[model samples]
Target: MAIPKYHELRISALRLLSDGRSMKLRDFLEPLANEFKLTDEEINEMYPSGNGHIFYDRISWALSYLNMAGLLDKPARGIYKISKKGVTMFNSETPEYINEFVDKEVAKRDKIKKNKNPEIKIIDLNDRQTPQEGLYTSFNNIRNSIYEEILTTILTKTPAAFEKLVVMLLQKMGYGGEIKNSGVVTKQSNDGGIDGIIKEDILGFGRINIQAKRYRLDIAVGREEIQRFVGALAVAQSNKGVFITTSYFSKGAIEYVENLFGNTTVVLIDGKNLASYIYDYGLGMQVEQTIEIKKMDTDFWDSMANQ
Candidate 1:
């Protein structure tokens, strides 16, 4: 099932904590996941940032909002319990009361700020996000879901296929002059750590060395692997290389490339970045739909004001 929205999570959390017993964050995750009827695959689903599970992240946000609104309290690290106010509202069968209480609290806080500093503008805390901010957040969530799907599909392909895909993506980004002569995958026997190569022009004045690593998502590409690719580049006398991996690179590997000082140029594309590029270049993806968000034309309105 799709993850629940923040309000839904908030209500769920209050129901779970209504017993007045504290619960660890980890303990709360599974019950919530089960309550939502999330399958194992859905439970393991990650945020596009690769930072945490999507369900867990949303629950955490819900907890944060509730705590700020005084509906929940953290008695200790990683532990959360319902506040007296939280229990009262949960027992009253009026979920909307929590919202009203939060709004009243915000107004009280704003009034205090205004009284303390007469010249200071008191912003309405209850109206935190503008319409534009809400729209952008929704757009980003949709975009991230697409990126995650792209990565999952790519992981199922063979290494050779992944290499070809990297080449195709680069071509779509305008790497080579034409599609027919843009790039080619090398024979395995003589590849020398290079999976493919892309010519920058018809005359081949510049070329980009490509090394595509179809790695396990949990593992990382280290500096040693990068060093091997660098050796291969040195053998070919090429100063430009692109190392694309379906996993992340270690800090050491990233630092090594940054310190090159123009000796050689290596562009690293991890799984997250590769998905971003694929989406940006419209490679292997179609236009699902278009959303247009329009704003007022201030210039036109100002011209009308002059009349």
Candidate 2:
């Protein structure tokens, strides 16, 4: 497997817990390694695929959700047990279909809450928000902005520099992209689209090849461009190519890339991806300043209200 999709990891965690052992996250993770045939370090290195760790967070939320909804139960903190509800679910399912089950439970919870609450749940828009909500919004916005900056930065740099920037950006997002923004990579003379490669796990080493392109948003990459990149991969006898572009791929371009070959494979990354990489890595963000500040002073507030 190139990378185990994070939802798979969540389901794996639950299946491990269902073993009737009181397990910590550490314990739960071991079976995942055995199942995936990976080491502990590999599990630690696998980052979430989308929305940063929110996908993993969603998985964690799903676990709690299953427990709360009575599909699973907790015997203790850090220990989860499959309830009768869970057993019924397990017997009727296959591993590939677990996500559907989690989604079902999530829906079930929403329906139950609606029946009991009846009134609209109080949700304040961020314009008038709770401290927790405000913090989440602020951080997420900062992360989004950083991704845009990275794409734009690449657009402005030389193609030679784009490869290094992409690696640095990946490292910033927390992927193990070992890149010195300036070295001649493995097939430096002959390889076409490939910049330096990034391997999240040694398992992914031969399975992945990454190509970087820097362009203005208006420039649309077409299928021929993708085909050329794929040909470069073939020269290296590689299985996959990731074409990362700062501009969008034409719809025809996307369809053409996917259908380009039966055994050959390529993944297209356009402007949207360029931004996501930045956000995923927390790229271009540094702590500029911080201050210890007082929260609302009760007396000051009271005086203002009286006046």
Candidate 3:
């Protein structure tokens, strides 16, 4: 069976977690996988392009999501019990108890947990204008926030969700890219490496091939992976590649790219850089404010003086 969406997986976990018993992520996920009829092979097919532990991270995300949605209260790494919300959610006798409950029933959660009266931020009406520059500033700020969210999401999200986000972002950036289900394995991966591909430009015009490595910590994409990516570029008869990751590259990997820049013009974006770019571009985020500025036409002014 095809990989389930992240939300779907979360809902499944929630329904099971709805029971009074404390459960582990694996406990809820494995049986849910069975109920969903996903074989190990099928399940393995869900990680993002370059990640190896897609399932494990995704399970983590499911648990985190339930906790945020006010359903399950996790006491530790592997243990979870139904919250007041969860227990009530389980008692529903409707056809669509899960999705419906989260949507209409669960109200928007407060950003911060507090029992005191909430303090709202007040903007100076005079300073906060909807002019051109103001608008641009607001828009950029919101976009950056979303990029941060997406990066954070990918850091612990399902491979399926990561892939969807990659596709969406690439498309927004006008990259002629495709997310092939290579089961998140790489040719350089003596164990398992590489992820998705982004063909940004046409062959002659130049193409940007992407290697997105979603990591949890500082893992250097060393000479081996860089070398393999180079080989892949050669196979495709292309000259440019991007090695992106949610971690730092080893010194060897950095030096290797420096050595090869004359040829492939490879670009490396570690997790921090990747997150910043997404923020700057406003991929999955919404625009907040718009601003405009006006200046006199210098040429016209000059002509008037001459006249």
Q: lDDT per model, in order? A: 0.81, 0.63, 0.62
Residue 234, model 3, lDDT: 79
Mind giving the per-residue lDDT tens digits that candidate 2 earns over 1-307? 3335555665666666665655554454445557778655554553333233333344455566566556677665546677876777666777556666776766676566447446423233536877766766656545544555566556667776777766666556555545333222335475566785655554554445677777787799887887787787888678766778898898888898767756787877777667776655556555543434357888877878453
Candidate 1 residue-wise lDDT, 158-224, digit = tens: 8889989998998888888663687988887889999999988777768899999988776899999
TM-score of each: 0.58, 0.43, 0.41
Ranking by TM-score: 1, 2, 3
How many clashes would you count in candidate 3? 14
| Alpha carbon deviation, residue 188, candidate 2 (Å) | 7.0
Question: In model 2, which regions exceed 4 Å deviation?
Answer: 1-131, 168-190, 198-207, 282-307
lDDT pick, better of 1 and 3: 1
Best by TM-score: 1
Off by over 4 Å in 3: 1-148, 177-194, 198-206, 288-307
- lDDT of candidate 3 over 205-277, digit per residue (tens): 5455656777764456778888898887777676877777777788898898888745677888876677776
**Which candidate, 1 or 2, would have the higher TM-score against the true structure?**
1
Model 3 TM:
0.41
Worst 10 residues of 2 by lDDT: 47-56
